[model samples]
Target: MSVDKLDMQSPDLVYQNIEKLAESFPNCVTESDTGKAIDFDLLRQELSHAVVEGNKERYRLEWPGKKEAIVTANLPTTKTLRPLLKESVDFDNTENIYIEGDNLEVLKLLQESYLGKIKMIYIDPPYNTGKDFVYKDNFAKDTQEELFESGQKDEYNQRLIVNPETSGRYHSNWLNMMYPRLKLARNLLSANGIVVISIDEKEVHNLRKLCDEIYGEKNFAGEIIWKNSSKNDQDYISTQHEYLVCYVKDKSINKGNWIEKKEGLDEIYKAFDSFKKKHGEDWEAIHQEALAWYKQFSESNPIFSSKHYSWLDEKGVYFPDNISGPNHGQYVYDVIHPITKEVCKAPSSGWRYPESTLKQRIKEKLVHFGKDHSTVPNNKTYLKNTEFQSLTSIRYKDGRVASKNLAKLFGENLFTNPKDPDLLCELFKSFELKENDIILDFFSGSGTTAEAVMKLNFETDSICRFILVQLPEDLNETLRTASGGAKATITRSIQYLKKFNKPTTIAELGKQRIKLCSANYTKKNKPTIGFRVYRLDDSNMQNVHYKPQEYAQANLDLFSDNVKSDRTADDLLAQVMLAWGLPLSLKIERLEITGKEVFRVAQNSLYACFDKGLDETFAKEIAKDKPLRVVFRDNGFKDDTAKVNVKQLLKQLSPETEMKVI
Candidate 1:
């Protein structure tokens, strides 16, 4: 029952060293032998001034393909996100995003635009049970893998391959799949960013170790024990709980994080106001009645509860909470006992605030007195006061709420065992998030996180955006009707149906859930309930990929003007946006100047003109407004004279603009 220390293999030291090197000098490190080795000479050259003479020992996480995973994260990807205007709702204004593709590639595409930008991330990933299928890293794909990547066109199952428990590297494969994505994910986090991952008992320990390596041991946030369900059927103890491991980008940034518990106050406060209006004349009886009500209150009646209420007056029910702990803060003059008409005792330590605060509280009638003059007065916290509660490590929520709603909307068990949206909202609320802050979920299964963000915003009345990335991995057998069963209450849609015999991926299901939530969550006063959709795909450019051997004059000339036939100018513009580090959700507008299509992003953050046969006039026109970045087709120049003139003119006009050709 114990591990064999000697028999177990240690991690590759060389790869560990390489990964450490790449962390500092990502630009210097280059992939060698098709991403199999690190070009150390090039790395050292890039860091020539600060190069280390020899290897220095340090504590780190090592795995079989740890170095390769680092390479994959650092490697430049040509992939781009194509806008799905037809499938999307409120394509221009909505802040939410639902992306369809492999998360690894999606993360790579997001690296530049989203680096140090995310505020919160919540992902529920694969649990790696015996029948689980993982992402096959294609850094060194073979012919079989290439075929699998091709999607087969007929077989729906080729995209996913099961890793049985009997396999020698069962856990290893899962780690490899998760490593690079998480590494890339880390770059997208802001200084105060946090990522919460929902995991099961099978991989909780392993996930913690992995997160410690990626997010650093010092930034290890607490984990939440979530009661996923209440099941009585099991051989042993019915495993009803799951774990949510959270990590912060930096610990110092969470100085003022808090969530106000407002559940039991809202409706009760309204009722109390009405009661006060009727009995404002007889404040003493009303206060007595409120005290009696609090004494008989049970948790079952959630609408009215005075758990924090201890003192009642004309102002209503409230508790005398210590302004400061026993031996803390500054002391002030003695506060008189209202009933005894005598000086009250002071705290052993002191008053919570200075004389100014005491005077202010007295002016506001916020000080509660003791029975006699011998007792010290405490700060009165009213029932109307917002009580900010600390985030609990243990959470109890019935996950069935999400499942039942999904069943009602989809009319079938589409996504099994979804995390409770209300629970997720509570977790997100604990962060005290704001309007500009973003919440990302790369593993956005069933769009629960998206709905949570929406519901949270609806309740808090904030405009926080959400970025949801979900793989087009098909649903498991239980949710599919491909085996010749009853018709899915919903018919199949999207081009995936043509390529896949049985059409449907987890992404499609998630998008549907988001739509349903947006429309149905509110009966009236419908908020901005919609999202923009983007799909992960190959580069819009033609097949002339950059390579050492193909870097020739003739090769460049032959393929210079050729872009993929299936792509549009908008597609090229999107690729340009990826190349430039601009948020994909940024506002974009199209303009036609001099009979050429021009795309402007975020007013002036970036500009793209994919028009061909460009002359000095167009360049000067675009240069009039010195945008941060300007992209054009390589062959857009009419001639060498025209190109030189355009460059010179642009420099003369918009010197701040960075101009580049595709």
Candidate 2:
């Protein structure tokens, strides 16, 4: 029996696209010099109802390097994520993940494992304000070599280069950086998933057009205007707002509305509880007390509007809604006054509900009646029942509050302009996500997205998890060019990192933020506060593993082993998991069977062993568990006979098991 060797590379998008086209139009597919390819002329004819033409003028957003961006997205990467147990909080059990690498490479590597699994994605990428840097993705070299040359592998020089306005490709640079990342990110979203991108005026228009191309114009959800600043320091207009562009993966599957639970409800409920205790069903007295409570808040406060629902009863505080129907009229019916025992005056339009429903409401004490029959009865709309509101298109919040809170959390202004966790918490609540839904943020700066998800989970008693990816941007290098307050802030951040002997990188600061957020939660209110840390690096496999045919027979003994010398069992396990399309967050358990170490992931889902000197005893012992898939090192067998014996043993025992080697 011959064992298959796993090709440790990301899923090939070009090949996947070819398969997708073949499924729809098999006649339009043809074989090329390289592989199966699409015949564009035939495909166009298949799509067109009339005659197909060539090079027709059409509206589209284009720029220099756009083709390169598309190529960058389709190209597969062999880079693998190595688990860092030393930097991780809860390496084995945590479902959350933190990755340090160029997000483009990370997104490519995650394509298979997380395909159509992510529920939501929120990114706060650089807005291209001419001062901030944009990623310089090199399409010529291997990803590992490119990262090292650009300073992203060992340092952070090649990845981030400032795009000044004086440059010829100012806008093109930003678009090129964002295009490939967004393209890869779209493949990870579920059918009903959504993605929100934050941008300023500088790139908002371009961003919308770019998104329109990537995510079809029909799937455009809406744009949210966040008015967060009040500065008046512009030349022509004082810009005080940034935008949040939202898009759904497939608009057909997203049928539910986004609603936000109104804030200050807790305070109102607490006050009502106190009044009910003191007055004991005396709604009039409670109404007077509530009126006095409303005086404490200014009109600008959101809770001040709650005073309209002042009427109280045994049921709770309620607003007396109009019984009249909307527009012209509804069901015309007469409601009787319970006190006067007479027919109440009907509304000019009609009753909002039908007679049967109105009678049921009157019986349930959900309708309010006047003392005399001359007035129309009102609907008792309880505050407790109307606690949710539709999310608005515009939001107003002071941006400085987030900076202040971050300062308080770290005892210094270590980060500049961090996002408000509270705001994101409210925004996430609007999604009404289900348990274990994942939220991803590739440009996770300051780790605010992680903190926001943690806070949301705690408040809602949810199990939603987050995956954050960030480059390890060196703060010391940034400090060299920073001036005034920016330089001082970097200095303070460097000093803070030195106290813990941590590297001075933005990723280190983000990890600390997540750790602090986790620590702040009490043990009783646990919400999966820990996360597994992974750093993107070269694949665990050696060059010979990928191209064994290129090597001559003379070097067969010299290149017998395919794995890197420095790689550990855990590293091999990680690469195997990726190759098998298993999530890195799955539960990992180490087992020792027949004196050979083995790793079982997510129970019987997969099993891997890289230990040497494997024999039939080890294979029989592992196969007894009946794993669905298993992998072993190619050079682990004691001899050719032992390898043959092990394969026969697995086939005899676990006949359904799919076995592979690397």
Candidate 3:
């Protein structure tokens, strides 16, 4: 907790210092008095090495073969085009995306284009239930080889039968499966973003500790309890609730507010009318009844008005709220009610507005009168618009209502559990989303996040987009068959099928509404392929013998042509932008005015250029904006003299910007 003890250095240095501190405070360092020295040093070394090894292994798998030509590329360039069958869904217009594959591979693939940009991520991962199978992650094999061996023809490479009870290291297997994916996911989160993971009692405690280690204990938000099931089983106590552990990327940034339902003026008017009908125009009786009703309402709806008061002479009611405060000095005065022509007293607390304003209200007949017009003195009261009230937190019960509706739309429960689209919609509504804000969901089960985002866009007329990722796991066929005879058969089929007649056997009603979505869907002008796919490969440099003149000519030609046909450089820059997970509308400007071409990416605040034979003055001009990041080609400098002092020049000119050369 002490700032001085933190060392205020890099992670490696801080960790080393922590170990030194632990040695000094042995009793405090050890959780128990076992007298055994804590292995903090060993643990840190193992963890750091493991992370490095995992990343290195993944890189090798992604880029397995490259024989000097450098023909291969990282990430997928071949797009998969599929038909848009559902009229309700528009794949191209919607910002949301649903990718079917192993989450591990998907996360790794995303690392090249989406790092540190996600805002809010919510995932319901496999709970490692004793019966559940753990993900079979073969970190050793090459990606292509692994895919081939798994017998996955145009699908996820492999599947493993992971029964926790039978596994030698149940907890360890789950940890290994989650570790790298979480590490990569953390890299994708924006600094102010938060991630929520839904788990059961079985692994809730373990997951909490794991997230703390990954996201830091300081970033841990509270655990939310979601009552998933309502019915009680007779055999034993029925399990109902699940836990959602939340953690933020950084604790310093504001996370905004949660969404809540609003009680409109119509509802307030209804309450008033009900109260008046039950308890006649007696001011005291009406006030008492209204107060009781409001209290009951507030118990269920936390955003309800707290204070209630009856109008002085009228049967109407109002809540005590400060319309104005102590800024403007005493402009207090009396006013006459327009209807009753009775004089109303201004509060001794001072009029809410200046005397001029009070006069304007009197002229406009905005004041009210009492029931006993002649006997009771009227007082000026401020009217607060109910619409302007602040929204409150929406509870889990409200979320369930929305989730049930979505369940009905799918016909059958397509997913064991789906997030309440309404809850997600509420969250989206709270933010001032632009058409370009890219929402991501790495745990996209049945694509609920995409559906929610699309619905929000339809309702708010905003063009916010989404990116959804889900592993292709086959549904249980037996359950489907039991649910609905022939209809169930269609649902259980691997290929998409339409249903014809309901309440009829498969033999009785031969007709079916089902139609299989095309594997590849193409546009009119462009190829049917949906995505541009590229595979990772090594650099194209080979060792060989050549004459000095020939070598120099080849080098010069390569350097010159590299500027003209530098697809690799262009692709790398694009991937970097994607890795950063910036919006697609981010500006890209290419300038060739200074004999060397430079690319300026406006959104990421980055400028990169790999042109050879660069000019020094041109470089200085490009560095003027103090971009957050800047990259230059190692071979592009005018000379070694120019390259050596470039760092110093940038340091003095753009102190806040980070400079790197490739």
Most lDDT-accurate candidate: 2
Task: Give residue 120's error in model 3 in angstroms.
Answer: 2.3
What's each prediction's TM-score? 0.73, 0.81, 0.50
Candidate number that wins on lDDT, 1 or 3: 1
lDDT of 3 by residue, 298-372 (tens): 665554545544332243445543433364545555555455676654445566666787566546534434453
What ranking of all candidate models by TM-score puts the best one first? 2, 1, 3
Stretches of candidate 1 exceeding 4 Å from the true structure:
1-68, 146-159, 163-168, 267-313, 319-381, 409-413, 476-503, 520-527, 546-559, 639-641
**Can you tell me which runs of candidate 2 are displaced by over 4 Å?**
1-56, 141-158, 271-298, 302-310, 325-378, 525-528, 544-559
Report lDDT (CA) for all predictions: 0.72, 0.83, 0.52
Give the alpha carbon lDDT tens digit for every residue of 515-600 in model 2.
88776653584544789999998777777343222221123234356788899999878777776778999999999988889999
What does each candidate score in C-alpha RMSD? 10.7, 12.2, 16.4
lDDT of 1 by residue, 27-82 (tens): 65443333434656556667577765655646665556667777876776556788
Looking at model 1, residue 175 earns an lDDT score of 79
Error of 2 at 423 (Å): 2.4
TM-score of 1: 0.73
Provide the global lDDT of candidate 2 against the true structure: 0.83
**Minimal lDDT window, size 10, model 2:** 547-556
